[model samples]
Target: MNATGRQTDLIEDYVAALTAALHGPARVKARMIEEIRDGLADTAAAHTGEGMPYHRAAHQAVQEFGTVEELVPSCQQELTIAQARHTARAVALTAPFLIACWYLAQAADHGHAWLLPRTAQLLAVHLTGVATVAALLAAATLAATGALARRMPTPHRLPLVVAWAGTTASAAMAVTTLAFATVSALTTNWPLLAFAGTLAAASHAAVAASARACRRCSRLPTT
Candidate 1:
């Protein structure tokens, strides 16, 4: 093969190995790979400019880029942050729909009366309160990881916080929803019950997936 062909093969092999070694959100991982590839290309070009052959420059670039083990710590940190952000976003986005499901079920139960049995009413109120708090926590977590990231002093343990908190909140919401659904089943219409159930299931799935990502990110070695 020509020097250019050999250089391309070497770079591609290195990138493929790196890619196989890391795991995270697909978009975040793809971006990281592209960024690394670009940096490698730039470094190789610099080496070539200094009189090195193309293939030799590619080898030098890969050497400088470090092995998968070496790159993983910093890359995993970014992935962890991405996973945390994803979980927070999932929780924030689903909060309103979940809240609305409860109200909708209540409305279907009482028509225009907008009332529930005393016990149901109390449970609903408490659930709403908890859900609201969880949503707020998620929003705050998102802000801390994003908009307020630079201004705010973020804790080093933020990813772990996100993993545990997000899992708890999401699981709580799911459990509460199932419990409320069971309690209101007799009073709530089948249509609304099905709708609320579907929404709850979807929210749970999204949040669970995000939480799993956060958990995986947490297990990675820290830089």
Candidate 2:
């Protein structure tokens, strides 16, 4: 009903939507909400001495402060970095398990004959998986770099270089994974190989999507 009440309601709704949309630890979402509120409050404070009505003042404050969508991407970028860090840790932890699964699949397929040395087969599979993971990491890094490049004032050429590198790495990894899976399926009929190929493709797609979003966001003029 009052100006303060209206502003408070708007902030509450915005924060609620943000909390629902952000995907990360609870603390990250809380911090994002607080930062948004402080940004809006600071904008409002700047206009407080202008003698505007409370409702008008708050509306102007929010208008000048910009919308949640604009601010949310920066927060999402931070969340993406956090998630990537988590993925790196998880990859490190579970790599051994994946290696074991590869050997088990190979052994099961071979009727326990042990034609290929188990150690050698495990090493090959580990190398393939590691290469796939490395490609995805390169893609993610390139996408972030591209996004950062778009934000710079002078249009630095390095982000574009990184982006191109990432794209090439992602495509190569996806193709390699698919080819390996196809060969394994035809020779050994291992379905897990197909699954690994799919995972590699999905990771590449995510990196591409992030790069595109970052590029778009970078084009927007800063407040």
Per-residue lDDT of 1-223 in model 2, one digit per residue for the tens? Answer: 8668987777567667766656543565578678877876666666677776666656776677566677666666565444443433333333333344445446545654433456445545655566456445544544554465377532333233333434443454455455546545564555665665555556556544444433333333332
Model 1 residue 194 lDDT score: 66
User: Over all chains combined, what TM-score does candidate 1 have?
Assistant: 0.84
What is the Å distance of residue 35 in model 2 from its true position?
0.7
RMSD of each: 3.0, 8.3
lDDT of 1 by residue, 68-162 (tens): 78988888878888888888888788867667877777667764443346765665687677568768878888888887988976667877777
Best by TM-score: 1
Give, for candidate 2, the lowest lDDT window spanning 10 residues. 153-162
User: How much lDDT does candidate 1 score?
Assistant: 0.78
* Candidate 1 Cα misplacement greater than 4 A, ranges: 1-5, 111-126, 176-185
Clashes of each: 0, 0
